[model samples]
Target chain A: MSNTDLEDDLRGTFDRAAASVPMATDLTGRATTDARRAQRRTWMISAAAAVAVASIAAATFGLSGGRSTPVQLPVAGGNAPASTSAVETEPSVETVSGTWRPVQMAGLKALSAERPEDPVLVFRPDGTWTGSDGCNGLQGTYNIGQRGEFTAKAGMQRLIGCDNVPHTGVLQSAKRIAVDASTLEFYGADGRELARYARAR
Target chain B: MEFEEYVSARGQDLVRLGFTVSGDYQRAEDLAQIALMQAFRSWRKVRKADDPHLYVRRILVNAYLSMTRRRSFTESPSAEIDPPHPVPDPATDIVNSDDLWRALAELSARERVVLVLRYYQDLDDRTIADMLGIKPSSVRSTASRALATLRKARQSHHVS
Candidate 1:
C-alpha cells in the first residue's frame, strides 16, 4: 500500500529468487582455463603474423627487380631494420574488395564446415558486407581507410541455432587488414592478428 | 588481489545477480562467464580501478542488456506472448508471493533491470544510468513505470 511496503516486497522477492538459484559450478576453473587458452592464442597469433609478414617481405624483395640487398622485415618485439630503396607494398582497394572464406576463425587454426555449408564473407566496395556464419545470415557495413585501417558494424542477423558456426567476434575486433594475392589477414586494435581468410574459389 | 582469488570471493554473487536479471539459470551462467572472461582478460587494468567488482558488474549488466536487445530483434513473435493471468487469493501469503513473482516477470527487461539495480544492488539512478548507458532521468522514468506496474498487479490481485 505504501512506498516502503513496495520496496520491502521487491527486496524480499528478489532475495528469494537469488536464493533459489544455485551458484554457477566450476566458474573459476572454467574462466581460468579459458583465459589461459586465450593468452596462448594471442601468443600463437603474434608469432604466426610475424612469420607471415617476413615471408611476404622476402617474396616482395625477390620480385623487386632483383635488388642487390635484402631489406630486413619486421619481427615481433624486434628492432626496426634499415630502410631500403625497394618500395614497400600495401594492399589496395582491388586487393581487399571481394568475397573471402575463413581459413581460421575464433582463435582456432582451421575451420572445417561440419555441415554441408561453409561460412563466407563478402566485403563490398560500397562499404557494406554480408555473410553466413555457416547457418545464420549476417549483414553489416564496413569502412576501410587509406592506410588499411578497417572497422565493421554488424546489422541484422538471423537467430538460427547451429553448432560450429564461425563467430563474428574476430571480424568485429579487426582494426586493420592486409591482403596479398590469395590470403587476407585481419589485425586487432592492438596490432595482433585476429583472423585470416583466403580468397574463395 | 589476484583474479582467481577475486573470483573465489565474489563470483557467486555475480552469477546470482545475473540469474536475478535474466530469470534463467543457464543464461545467467553464460552471462557471468562472459563477463568474468572479459574481466580476466583485462584483470590488470580492472584491478587498478577504484572498484574492480563494480567493473565486472557493469560488464555483466551490459552483456545481459546486449543479449536481450539482440533477442528482441530476432525472437519469434509467438515467444513474446504471455500466458493468461490467474486470479490470486488474498488470504494466502504464499499465493501473494507467487503473484509478486509473476508480476516481476511480467515487467520488461529494462524495467526489471531498473528495479534489480535499484532494489537488489542498492544503486542510485545515476549509477544505474551510467551502467545502462541511459540518461539519469530515463532511469528514473523506467523505475517509476516498473514500480507502477508492480503496484497495479498487486492491487488487481487484492480486488479479485
Candidate 2:
C-alpha cells in the first residue's frame, strides 16, 4: 500500500480509538490544587533549611558572646507591626532564608493587580538566592553585613518580559532585606521600599 | 488570558493528546495532569510564549517519554501465558481498524510517538521536531521508519 494510504489508515484508526476515551471533568481543579501543593512543598523545604541555618548561627553567636537583642519570631496568625524599625532590631538567619511571595511593590501596584500567582523569592543558607517575579527566573548570591545591611550580587536571569512587571528592578535593587513575622521587605540603597513579600504557605 | 481560563480552554485537548501518545485513557489523564500542573507553576512564563499550546504539548511529550523510559526499566515479569490468537488477513480485511491499532501498539515508543504526532495530531515535521526536541530530518526519518514497521506488521499478519 502507498504511504499516503497508510497514513490515512493510521489517522482513521487513532481517531476512532481516541473518540472512545472519556473526558476528565475535574482536571482544572486537580491540576490547580497539585500546583499549589507543589509550591507549598518548595516553601516548606526552604523554610526548614532556614530553620536549620538559624540554629547553627544562634549556636555560633552564643559561643562567641554576641550582643543580646530581642528578635520577633514568626507567629502563626499574628499581625506584624506596621513599623519597619520594630522588625529590623536583630535580623536572624531564619528571617533571611525561606520562600517569600511578593505582596506589594511600591509604585508598581499595577503589575500586582491582575496576577493571581505572586512572584517568589527563596533565600538559601548557602548564600545563594533564587526566585521568579511571576515571569523570569532569578538567581544570585547574597551577603548580610553588620547592622541590618544586605547586598546581593546581580545574577543571571531569563529575559522573557511580562506585562507591567518590573522584575529586574525588584530583584536587582534589593540592597536591604528585613523580615518581621510573616512579612519580608526588600529595600533599595536609598532606603526606599522596592518590594514587600509575605512568608509563602 | 488568565491561567484558569487557559486550563478551562485547553485542558480537554491536552488530555486527548495525552491519550494519543500513551494509548491508554487513565495514563492519558495522569500525563495531562502532570503536564498541566507544570504549566500552571510556570504559567507566567508559559503564557507569554508565541504558542502556549506548543509549550504544553512539549511538556506532555516529555512526560510521556520519561514515563515510558522508567516503566521500561521497572517492568516486572509476566506470569500468565498468552493463548495463540489468529492474525487477521489484510487481503480480506484491508481496512481493519483494530489491526492497525494493534500494530501501532507493537511499535517502539519513539516510533509510536512520531506516528501519533504526524498522523493523529496532524502536525508537520517541523512542529513535531520542535515538540520532541529533534531535528526536522529526524522527524521525517522516524515517521518513515514507523510507517515501514506498521506496513511490515500488516503484511506479516496477512501472511499468517
Candidate 3:
C-alpha cells in the first residue's frame, strides 16, 4: 500500500481498536478510591489512573524484595568471546589464573536474589572482569594501573543501579584487604568475614 | 481535589482507557480502582508534581505493567457496553465494538499499552516513555509497530 494509504489505515485502525473495547463500569470510581464529598464544584479528574495502569502492579510483589537491594535492570551485556584473551599467557591479569572461590559477599547474593537477571563482575589481572550480575552475565575490561593509580581512582565496579552510593561498605573492606593486609577475606553481606588468609604462596 | 468529585469527572475516561488497554472490563475496573487508591494515598505529594495528572498516569501505567501479580487480573470477557448514543449508520461504523475488542486482544500486552497511551490517553512519546520507564525512542518504535498490527487486523476484518 502507499504511504498515505498506510497512514490513513493506521489512524483508522487506532481509532476503532481504541474506542471499541468497553470502558470500565464506574472506572474513575473503581480505578481510584479518590472522591470529594464537598458541595457542588465542577472540574475534577476522576478515577483517571485506573484504565491506564495494568499488569505493572500485578507483579509488584516480585519487585518489592528486589528493591531492598539495588538490582540492575538488564541491558543485554554478555560474556566476552573466548580468544587469545581467554587462554593466553600474558603477564597482565586477564585470564582466570586462580581457582574460583565463593564470593562470600552477601551484598551480591542479596542483590542477585532480587534481580538474578542483573550482571556481576569478577576482576582479573589482565584487564578484564566477569560474572553474572543480578541481570546479565558479562566480562569486560579491567584497567589496573599501578604507577598512575588511575585504575585505583577509576576503581573496580559492577553495574547494578543504586540511588547514589552502593556496595559502599563491602568494596571498601575488600580494597583495604587487597592493598594493606596482602590478604583476602571472604565476607557475607552482614559484615561477618567468612575466611581470611595471605595470598597463596 | 476532593476524592469523591475527582471520581465523578475523570472516572469514565479512566475506565475507557482501562478497557482499551486490557480488552477486559473486569480487569480494567480492578486496575482503575487500585490506581485510584494508590493515587489517593500519594495525592498530597502528587498534587505538587509538575503535571499532577502526569504523575497519576505514571502510577497507573506502573500498575498496569504489574497486573500479572494481582490475583484479580483475570482474562474474562468484557462487561457489556451500552453505548452513550444509539446506533448510527452501518457503513460508517465499518467495524463494530466487538470487532475492535478482538483486534485489541490480538495485540501483545506491550502493544496494547502503547496504542492505549498513544490514542486513548492522548499522551505523546516522551510522556509514555516516562510512564513505562523506557526510553522515548522505544515508545515511538512500539507505537509504530503496534499501529501497524492494528491496521492489519482492521484490514482483515474489512476483507472478511
Best by DockQ: 1
lDDT of each: 0.70, 0.68, 0.47
lDDT of 3 by residue, B1-160 (tens): 6655666666655555666666666666666676676566446655667876666666666677767445665556643343433555654434354455566677767777876787656788888887887899998888777667766776787798
Residue A183 in model 1: lDDT: 75
User: Which scores higher on DockQ, 1 or 3?
Assistant: 1
Q: Please identify model 1 stretches exceeding 4 Å from their true place.
A: A38-201, B72-94
Best-first order by TM-score? 1, 2, 3
Model 3: how large is the Cα RMSD against the reference? 18.0
DockQ-superior candidate, 2 or 3 = 2
lDDT of each residue in A1-201, candidate 2, tens digit only = 888888888887778667766768888899999988966764454345344434444555567675334233222233552225444434444566788777766554465555434577788864568877666777765555434445554455666656435544555555456677777776554444556777785
Which stretch of 10 consecutive residues in model 2 chain A shows the poorest summed lDDT?
A: A67-76
TM-score of each: 0.58, 0.57, 0.46
| Model 3 misplaced stretches (Cα beyond 4 Å) | A1-201, B69-74, B78-89, B96-100, B158-160
Report the lDDT tens digits of candidate 1 across residue range A36-129: 7866765565455445553544455456643434323322223642222132235444556788888754335337747445688887753468
Local accuracy of candidate 1 as per-residue lDDT tens digits, B11-107 = 9888888877877777778878888987886687679879889889988988887787874533212111123345544435545655677787778
Supply candidate 3's per-residue lDDT for A6.
Answer: 48
Native A-B contacts reproduced, model 2:
0.77
| Whole-structure CA lDDT of model 3 | 0.47
| Candidate 3 chain A lowest-lDDT run of ten | A38-47
